[model samples]
Target: MNRCLSTLAKLDEEGYSAPALARLADRRAFPPRLEFTRADIMEIRTRTAAHMSISGVQEKISLRLHRGKLQPVTEDGEYILKPIPGLALPRFQEDVPANENLTMQLAEQIYGIHTAPNACIRLANSELAYITRRFDRRRDGTRVAQEDFCQLMGKTPESAGPLYKYGASYEELGQALRKYCSAYPVELEKLFRQIVFNYAVANGDAHLKNFSLQQTATFGDYVLTPAYDLLCTKLHLPEESRLAIDLFAEDEEPESIATYGFVTGADLLDLASRFGLIEQRARTILNDICDHRDKARDLIARSFLSDEAKVVYQAIFDERLRALEIRG
Candidate 1:
């Protein structure tokens, strides 16, 4: 019997399980095979690029789950579909979708980070694509007011230059959250845990545009939106920067990050201090994050990454864990 790629459950001839299908939509059958080809997706991407608010090198098309089947749409999309990109020349491009799917699942299932609902689905060519239901959209198709850190900081390519999004520190994001979010202490801890999780998984692309705040039911209140774009970028872009942004701003680095030249548990404790957390609370978070090695490895084993990719992925994971240098 084969394993269901979507849920990683034992399959009884049906490729997806009831729970996995339900995750896509209540009582939904396996999404009907996409009517368009990858080439069709490229053409649509070209025509729709100006209209889409989401940004990245990978090609993505807005989709809506209509009447139990997924269909591509140019407007008011309830889900976002990302096929293996044709650009940027990343290594092991075929594994990119599964890499993202596995990383997102690890964040949500293992570390308990709130992530956008996501899964791996088959493209028309039998290739895999990453799909996530849009958290900013409601069942009735209204848009939620959400703003990424870049926007919150009033940054743009023109204002801050080409690498604008990468120019800041995670500490700046924490400060921004403090000013905007009414529930600062609680959300700050969530942000700290997310940063630790990103390091653990080697998601080096967690930039300003990747984190956001969404308006809540209280009219003016805001909170961190569910995590999106979570992935092990090191697997694809091995030679790229270790992190999209510095863990701390200049003049704020602890001796550990300054001397050792990478993040250590000490540096994280310093960051938590900068975020106004007490030392003991920070250590507890770090210890808790460090204790999840076996669970992460088990999920990696069950993921859909190719055998070669899986080995590289685990190697990256182990190396990042060592770099963290968690203490007693």
Candidate 2:
């Protein structure tokens, strides 16, 4: 077995120890983790393609996984398999587990309100393992037309400057959002709930790359995919930041979407109203979120995160709820 893989196995067998992992991380420039060999990468690609019929996988987005030679199984007609990076080990670093756990918790909370792709497995070879369901696949080997918010704004990840640049006022984007909601009323309502949930959880990283539109032949139109990559970064990052392109105009904050372009309470209500949700239903949803604070906290603790990470996670939840003035 590879040294990194062996170490990871030992760590997993013994259970996660934050102090030990921290020390190990300090000792090496790179995290003491395994890397998938070319053979492993090919095998994964072949297997995924065989099972799902994904034909091409690109090394876009983050280079970490691509470096491991693991391509996204785009040919898979049903799901996408995100191979774990060899160098990315599973440790309590930056509260990643907490983030993932939070995704699952939020999924359950908004059960009918939001739709997220399933997280099938958490693989651990030498480093962190993430196996998420592919939302861009169909039953047959066909490609789904999709566009990230960034692409719509003519920006790549590297070119993405300030969130405010791709402000919500872009007439095209506004029209797209309006059209998507008009056609998919049910899905749009769920998405609106997800936006509110992100704010309540203090997910300051909800930027354009995080949102996307899926085009399908059945509807012969484009619509937003179920929510994915939901992590509360407010607790992990500095203060007074958000992951929205606009503020207040859409939800509840007094700021204009063009000004302080973070998703706020004002944005949520605005979206709800657009989706035909009355004040009473919208308020009820907000109240339900406030009531689930304790639940979110408990779920954080239960996730595969260190105790300290849990505390940090919970604190963010508390702070965000208070900031939103959400009452249980």
Candidate 3:
């Protein structure tokens, strides 16, 4: 009857389209509401802190598709459930789940960026939680080899200090991909588009851990994993930095940043040159994203975010567009 998180399709009261159901389950059955509330998740997180391998600020738990319903699990979870953050979190905290769902959808459906399959589902308390199927696990339960840029660069909190993940610029990520991925040329474009998309959507948390390389079907060859942990951080932390990390290292930074105190489209094109993309290819990609404003706005309208949150999200996007010089 309305847009569901799975496909944003309007077909069934179950809030899932036929295709979404097929992708999420073999029986095409709608998953029952979660059995636990947000408070329950916080309790479980505290109790299981020592044993849990997954780490993040938000309270989350592993889940599995069991007997046509989603079930919480301690291990071998196929999906990750992120409820609204705790009370001590930033502003507009309750909108986090819906914001993530809509942003991920915009990345995949509108900008053609590869992303983890995600949706917002209601909890037992009727509050929404963001659910994402893990990309690191295969259907038969075999684990794929994956490494975030932090590991790939051999940096740790102890060795590189607490802010290690935010220490490097996005240029270093491209360098890592060039060094590790045999298919460097193709993956470079994907990385570039991802960065541009992040800026467009106000996803300020595109840090080293968020961008990773995964082992492909061919052994020893790794490529950029589908995007994950994407959301409009500006909505929750309005005064934070525009991006998690800088676009270039100090020496390679475009003159525009020093002159204007911000990044410009010309600076991005320069960065593309550093990544081995010719001017034509870079301009084409930039133009393509700029052209998607209408579609992105439409998805935001269809999103489950409250009216006030939607307005804030659109205004942030518009500001980013101007900053990047994509809009006149």
Candidate 4:
């Protein structure tokens, strides 16, 4: 684990920052050369002993050859390795530190929402690397059935619009949630917390693909995966033309802000009702999120972000939390 961390840190030092990789070019620094091989991949698979194969090309997924005894990857499960791409990194350079910071903060926030696996290692390579424990695996090594939100709702990755268009409407999603979730107010509260955390962190990228339902044969149903890929992209990026995705049954137009755009408190209330949460419970969830604004602010300040970036983050945090009127 120490070696892995050291290697990642060295990669970041050599200029493989997230922004640089997103932009696909080195800006003020050069990236280090870390060798990834088939043998190393095999070792990672054997040790973590998870049976899975790399399935996509948009991002590269490799097995970790030597992760020590920490068992970074889950037992008999695969791990995802997203190397920072050269081009995309530079495009998002200014926001890199903030994005990374948000990822860490999000992991903590989700602890209050649901049982998310730990995401401790973030690589500073040509592209920002996010490693996560694969939850869609059984104790023995069978791949539990899993469906990307996009595919489940009959959409493709590329066809996904600027806003998230690859999934079912909020109404449809709510139905699914009710079927899969614990059907308790406490669980619903956690879901609300997740929504608030995303908005508070300015994670404009929380589209359908970002969240998914995992189908476990043992459990005989689908459930939300512990949150993964939780990062703040809006703070450093330019204003987007659309919200992450429409949450209610609104016009199919793009939205500027996620919360206020098509989905309002009314929409949230509707969804909550379907999920078995009463209006007051929903309000309580909002209030709890609002109360955490200061904590979010502090987390941003403590990150490796620049001063200018920190101020930007603070401003966004204040505006969003205040708009929602969340109280401690």
Q: What TM-score goes with each of the models?
A: 0.93, 0.61, 0.95, 0.65
Worst 10 residues of 4 by lDDT: 1-10
lDDT for each of the candidates? 0.82, 0.50, 0.83, 0.50
Q: After superposition, how far is residue 245 of candidate 4 from its true place, in Å?
A: 0.7
Residue-level error in angstroms, candidate 1, position 215: 1.1
Candidate 4 — which residues are off by over 4 angstroms?
1-58, 65-77, 88-101, 107-111, 115-128, 138-140, 157-167, 179-189, 216-218, 250-267, 270-276, 326-328
lDDT per residue as tens, model 2, 1-328: 1112111222433332443233222222322232453346546555544444332232111112233232343333232334322333234443553355455446554333444433322333433332333566553546678877666667753665454334453223444566654465554555556666777767766666677888867866777876776766555554646544443334344443454443445555655665566677777776677767655665565554457767777777776666555221
Residue-level lDDT of model 1, residues 254-318, one tens digit each, is 57655776777777788899999878888888877777899888888888899899999999998
Best by TM-score: 3
TM-score, ranked from best to worst: 3, 1, 4, 2
Top lDDT model: 3
Question: What is the overall TM-score of model 1 with all chains considered together?
Answer: 0.93
The parts of candidate 2 lying over 4 Å away from their true place are 1-94, 109-113, 120-127, 151-166, 169-175, 180-184, 248-267, 270-277, 326-328
Q: Model 2 compared with the native: what TM-score?
A: 0.61
* Models ranked on lDDT: 3, 1, 4, 2
Per-candidate Cα RMSD to the true structure, in Å, reads 2.0, 10.5, 1.9, 9.3
Clashing pairs in 3: none
